[model samples]
Target: MKPVSTWAAMLSLSLAMAGCVTINIYFPAAAAEKAADRIIDEVWQLKPDAATKEGAPSR
Candidate 1:
């Protein structure tokens, strides 16, 4: 009974320590924002002012 309780305690302690680990992750916020902006621009098909282009063909 004592050995079983000790084993259980050790297992719980190991699991607790594993759960408390702090993992540091590096993220490039500026690059992510730029990429997101580019995707949004592509999705919206943003274009410059049509009137500004003197040579633009009109349909």
Candidate 2:
């Protein structure tokens, strides 16, 4: 009984420490493009929709 309770306490402490850990991640992004006049055609794997073509309004 003592060993089982001690093991549970240790496991809970380890889990609490892990949950308190902080991780930081950074991603590079384009803030501004040289051709600001041009419309954005794509982002990542996304492409422009036919209804959202440049110089035309969406239906």
Candidate 3:
């Protein structure tokens, strides 16, 4: 009974510590979107077939 109670207490303490950590990350979503657009434009220029055609039959 003592071992089981001790194990339960230890488990509860570790679970409490899991939420105490801090993470900081910074990313420029606008800059990333601009870069992605440029890449897609370049790829589309290289392969015009990749562009979706207007008035095409929908799948």
Candidate 4:
């Protein structure tokens, strides 16, 4: 009886521990940096006269 209870406790503990695992995924730093730079450049490339030209009312 005691052995059975001990085995049950250990099995339950192992299962609980198994559910607590973590997996880490990594991104390549250089590629990520380059992508970020490209995005920043595109965001900053808006033409200064775009609003005036595009917002003018047409007859």
Highest lDDT against the true fold, candidate? 4
Model 1, runs deviating above 4 Å: 1-4, 46-59
TM-score of decoy 1: 0.58
User: Of the pair 3 and 4, which is ahead by TM-score?
Assistant: 4
Q: Pick the candidate with the highest TM-score.
A: 1
**Residue 27: error of model 3 in Å?**
0.4
Q: How far does residue 48 in candidate 2 sit from its true spot (Å)?
A: 10
Candidate 3's TM-score reads 0.40
C-alpha lDDT (0 to 100) for residue 7 of candidate 4: 80
> Taking the candidates one at a time, how many backbone clashes does each contain?
0, 0, 0, 0
Global lDDT of model 2: 0.65
- Model 1 per-residue lDDT tens digits across residues 1-59: 44568888999999999999999998799999999999998978845555357677655
Q: What Cα-based lDDT does every candidate model obtain? A: 0.83, 0.65, 0.78, 0.89
User: TM-scores, in order shown?
Assistant: 0.58, 0.41, 0.40, 0.51
* For every candidate, C-alpha RMSD to the true structure in Å: 8.9, 7.6, 5.5, 5.9
lDDT string for model 3 (1-59, tens) is: 44568888999999899989889887799998999999998877864443446544545
State the weakest 10-residue window (summed lDDT) of model 1. 46-55
